[model samples]
Target: MKITTPRWALEAAGAIGAEMAGTIAATGVRVVGDTALLSAVPEAVEKVPAAPRIAPEVAAQALYGALAAVASAPVRHSAPAKARTVHQTSSKELVRVLGHRCLKRLRRR
Candidate 1:
């Protein structure tokens, strides 16, 4: 069994999220008067903090962790590869949703 990521896009997002966490007051900040921890209230997440920035090293490692997660996510493979809706695919399909810019860049690779 091998693990794989959803795609380059998702991993990039996760990395960004992790990087932002560091400056998120994380320990405490304006508004909420320094709770030191985000309570995960839907409104709080939506209203304040406005998101934060992280150290570049943290950002890269965060990206790495996302990549690792993609590499280690659980995948459910059906029994014996039988009776499934399978279709042949081309590399083009892989990058189609990636948008013209990304696809064009990958072409260079």
Candidate 2:
């Protein structure tokens, strides 16, 4: 039978989680701590399609691995033009508040 990951699982994992999950699947047997070997956890997790259902240990490994890689990457000191423009946008967005009247209308739906 063909196996595929579900939409809900992908959504929960988000961009980062999806990458991490893929890594976990690719690296079947990984050495976690000094004496701990996560040889079977990834395989067990792959048998299932849901991300949330994955074992905590496996998930932790994926998250840590992804985070560490990101942390070690080189940093860019300058922001792109688009990002700079957005950062300098008007402060109107911060002051605007949707009062009770707007909330009541939304609740009707």
Candidate 3:
């Protein structure tokens, strides 16, 4: 017995394959089937010192302070809505009329 993959599955696989091939070519990486080979090992650079760790209590306090600051900030209401122009209104009406006409035609078919 033979099993066949669905057309959509094949299409999706093809798209993914194309994307992977493009990415590999763009990045100048060499690949043999599933395995990727590095052309050269990059030289190691001196690492920057990591930031000092904050105490749990200090971190908690800072988080609470930030939340409190945000909560206490005044809320600004948005400005009133602008009036619609004749062009905008007419376009909307036109779309509604066209949509109804299309629906009527479709139903009659």
TM-score of 1: 0.23
Which digits, one per residue and each the tens of the lDDT, describe model 2 over residues 74-95?
Answer: 4333555466664554344212
For residue 77, model 2's alpha carbon misses the true position, in angstroms, by 0.6
Give all candidates' CA lDDT scores: 0.47, 0.48, 0.54
Give the distance in Å from residue 95's predicted Cα in candidate 1 to where it truly belongs.
13
How should the candidates be ordered by TM-score, best one leading?
Answer: 3, 2, 1
Q: Give each model a TM-score.
A: 0.23, 0.26, 0.27
| lDDT, model 3, position 75 | 34
Per-residue lDDT tens digits for candidate 3, residues 1-109, read 2355665666666666667667887887765665222222234345566675988899977855554454444433233226544454454444444555554564589
All models, RMSD in angstroms? 19.8, 20.3, 20.5
Between candidates 2 and 3, the one scoring higher on lDDT is 3
Q: Distance (Å) between predicted and true CA of 29, model 3?
A: 19
Once fitted onto the true fold, the runs of candidate 3 whose alpha carbons sit more than 4 angstroms away are: 1-38, 43-53, 80-109
lDDT of 1 by residue, 5-107 (tens): 4445555655665555556756565554433233322221223433447778999777555544443443344444465434533344323323444434545
Best by lDDT: 3
TM-score of 2: 0.26
Backbone clashes for every candidate come to: 1, 0, 0
lDDT, model 1, position 42: 22
